[model samples]
Target: MQARQDATARAVENADNLARVIEHDITYTSQLTDLSIQAAVDGAQDADVMRLPDHLRRELLFDRSATASQYIGSLLCLDSRGKIIVDSTSVVPRSVNLADRTWFTVHRDNPKLGLFVSRPLQSRLNPGEVDLMFSRRVNHPDGSFAGVVVAAFRLDYFQNLLSGVKLGPGGNITLLQDDGHVILRYPNDGTPVDENFSGRKNFERFRQTHETSFLGTSGKDGKERLYNFRRFDKLKMIVIIAPAARYVFADWTSRAWYIGIVTALLIVGMLFAAQLLSVEFRHRLVVEQQLRDMTRIDGLTGLSNRRSLDDRLMLEWHRAKRSGKPLALLFVDIDRFKRYNDTYGHQAGDDALTAVAQAIARNSQRPGDIAARFGGEEFVVVLPETDGAAAAVVAAAIHAAVRGLAIEHNGSEHGVITVSIGVACTDTEEVTDALGLIKVADQAVYRAKASGRNQTSMAEPFGGAAVTT
Candidate 1:
């Protein structure tokens, strides 16, 4: 049984690690692919290389694919003026301005070879419109500077590449522009070109970063998405990969029969082991709870002890600080505990104290308040998110409750057992630590005892005292 539990734990850990590994592997692969494509695009960013003219380039590369066996790999074409032309008769974008073509740049000003890629044009000349254009400069047969030469590539190659890779179940990959337009998606959901999430927050952020990824809710189905992105300079596009956790986990359930059989055998062993563990766990839990109870509770009055008082004070002090509200601490002491305990057999004295503790607890009606036994006949109550006036009213209730308890001690001078209460409130300024707040409340307690017994005394956070004794 023990071994089975260990095996189950190990399996869970292994599965979690494997999920992370898979995520990391796909993220890295996407990053590398993006870099390679960008490198190809950057090679063409050179203005001088793009200066090649179309007419001269067509002449140089005219049917070169026929003579050179392979794909003419990349043909560089040039015009008479040595400038590259980007005019395409096909794929006329309705809203797009042709003057913005990258290939028409002043490449001569920065003469350097560049690798480039251009989207497909809708024309019979560009039968498969997606074109990969590589541009470079060289001298002509006459030794004069030749026009820029561009090698046109078909888009079919990339369409195949995007679909070929093995991304896990529900794993998605897309290429978009830094300007927020998504160029393409794998496992096509058929989102239109312009109507998609072009102006979303992600697109706005894309320009500020070269790469980005996050665990977020998917924009498509509102499901959890682990999104990874890489920016490609060659095409001036950002590539994003997203994997859904729910769909990924669902695959394991599809093979539930096999998993269930194994789990059944494991469960039998776990039950036996759990019995042994539960025995030890329960015993320890009981002892720990007893110790905790003792620490917080008063020995004589059966009320919350000094430790609880300190803890409550700390909580209330911090709460008041954060919210700009106020917290109140009330300290209560038996008017004559030592004398009463000495005169009455400590038994009767203990009874009187217990009565007061119960009364204080009963009177602390607010949900945001605590009444605790501080020590040796002394007690404290904490009120959180409160103001000075609120505290004073609570303090008065505590005083009244103690008197109403009607527990009589023949030795006491008063008709029955009674308490002197001190109220200190603060919106939390000047106190350096939680302990400082307690000290201020204790000072109020002292003043209440000084004024008289069976009454209440209130003080400003750090100032004048008012007595109701």
Candidate 2:
């Protein structure tokens, strides 16, 4: 009787150790996957997917996470109505409406549900394969539901991870949602995925506490087994490792000395695997950060891209509004750029553009200021807390810097490259929002061009004349 009791205690201890290893693996995977989804969300907000071309939009929203992770089946962005607007798998999203899907509805209905893990379900995109989805809610600037960013993982991936460990006869590993829905089970015994075990007596213990290991009867097979379970409160996940009590006792009786040595070796191997995964997780985070930084910069001139400009403009607009401080915008356009391209080859034009962009970047060196290539030969400089006069001084400095480069532009009357500058300030009564400010600044640019090629023009205050410097 004493020997039997000792074997049971050893079984419980082994199962508990194994459960901790599985929990570590899963927690890391989930955190990394969620981080990828969040990156997608931030990208979506920075770029307007609706206006972008299919391939460009997909590239903007999904990064290496889509293709780099072996376990991830796909990454997706759905619209407010649950229409798939962006998909990582194809340039063009599949024509599928997931309005009825539980994951979609949960996010759409619950604004505060930051991250969610869905029950296992067959993938609609990949017909034969089952998936477990990790999703986060997307919201508009006003906090209305915009959509969801989803990362789908193949159910087989979890099953394979769980099956790697050797368990004696009638041994099994199960992953469950907090609600007791089985996500995956190793050595599948024909039990359905997503089968609810909340009502089972064995699961009752898990609901009552964070971790446990004991001998209990199998709720399904009616056989005695040593069960070990661990719960992740934040992730709402549960992992269970169970081996039949009969097998444990028989093995212990026949080779008690060998059992301890084997268990030690298995534990070491699992710990090593966990360490490797940790290293991989940290490496992925670094890669993701680099990718995000790449997206915000213009490839040609090394200036802030249009997408980045939009985000910064919106952010500054709100800050200026709240603080009641003046915000200034400068619109700089290369004088007769098309003629410059015609006179010099496209490569020379690119060089000239880069030089001009650097000049503009140099003048707006304030920490709060942003200089961006608006598009082509057009550039914008955002100056926070600056009035029209200060903005014009910055614009004049940019004008002088371009003239200093003295790049030959035979197409221009000056016989050298020059730029037209338009300055606008939010202190004007007519400017109501960031878009309005941009429009005013653009009109000022046109006025500067109309006056001459190398000058600065500031938008007129209400009921006043335009200022040219």
Candidate 3:
């Protein structure tokens, strides 16, 4: 239940954020449209019809895709007769008749309309792509209404805005006008373009209320969802962030499975103690514990095995992301381990490896931290909520602990055996995958060896400098 609540809270927060973004984009595009209109009016003041100066034309024609506010794909100046005078997209403007377009006709019919946003449609310049035109009435210098100034905003703009959002499998986010036209839907191959949802219960409820959030079933798929919406009054649109109910309850299901497993273990233990009460029961308990441990424990070092590390890393990664914390990994390798095995024989090498593993286990004191043997003279320590600095300190302590063993090594630079430690950490925002952390830590270990063994090094997140000790 707690897991379900957490998921819902996260979904609500994410929805709120997405709503703000959509609202802001609407306002931004509206402002840009107004600015474009003013520029057109200024440029056309003394023209035979509506002519733009060379500089003004170039400014409007400038490619905005490379810049931050490149949402506007193209701009155009039109005459009162709805004839294209200047197209910002081309050096030599092409003649396109816009007199029949809704945005053009609407502004042409009504001179009082300040800014009009049209429904999604294919662009005149690029017929393959869908676009929305934000247009405003352009009045002639003599006060009569000239043609409309149009700012064509590609639908790709909205797609880019919502691309970074992560809705788990089967989840979806959508942008819809209050009139029930679907502007965009993610995981769609542009098939839902201008889809009318006016008759859908969810759309009707969304339009009828001024609420920011709603819980309902999707009319399209019958999947129950928690929908959070923000209305863009200027654009007459709403951005809906919805995650499927099943996805939201996934964590709760995982928790229930864990609870069931623990209950079964408790029942088994109780039955053995109450009924079979003797030496046999005690022996059975030990055997059962050993059998359970075998799957996740290293037989030689008595430390957690690679399988345990993988599971713990996954769990800790999720916890760190949810808690907005950091997770650190220490990849420790015995320096010149192969040479030591060759010189000291396999038995002595094994003893040294066991001692090093014990030191690492002792140093990772936190209940949430895990120490595991990652196969053949390599071990890993996982520290949840620990940053790079703290992990470095732990790395230094592990170095000292292992050095205290004083296991002789003739092949190593140092007289006594030492281990190279590589530390890597990821903050909540940077948590893309758990495997990335391991790869980074492994690279850091390689750096430690390159710089001279018996040292501690930290891998910088996202290819930054490596800090060494």
In terms of lDDT, the best-performing candidate is 2
The model with the greater TM-score, 1 or 3, is: 3
Tens-digit lDDT string for candidate 3 (1-469): 6766777788788778767876886677667656765666565555643345655654643333234247777778777888877777775667878889999889878878877878898887787989888777777767687777788888887778778878777678778877878889986745468988788787777667755666788777788888887777777887787888777778777887899799999998998777667778789989999998998899999999999899989999999889989889999999999999999899998898888998999999898999999989899999998999899999999999989999888888898899999888885233368988888888889889999889887777656546565
For each candidate in the order shown, give its overall lDDT on alpha carbons.
Answer: 0.59, 0.86, 0.80
TM-score of each: 0.41, 0.52, 0.50
Q: Rank the candidates by TM-score, best first.
A: 2, 3, 1
lDDT against true structure, model 1: 0.59
Q: Which residue runs of candidate 2 sit more than 4 Å off their true CA positions?
A: 1-5, 47-50, 66-68, 208-211, 251-469
Please provide, for model 2 over 33-120, each residue's C-alpha lDDT reduced to its tens digit, 9 standing for 90 to 100.
8878998888776547647888887887787575435799899999999889999888878899998889999998899988988889
TM-score of 2: 0.52
Stretches > 4 Å off in candidate 3? 1-6, 45-68, 256-469
- How large is the C-alpha RMSD of every model relative to the true structure? 21.6, 41.6, 34.9
Question: Considering summed lDDT, which 10 consecutive residues are worst modelled in model 1?
Answer: 89-98
Candidate 1 clashes: the total is 28
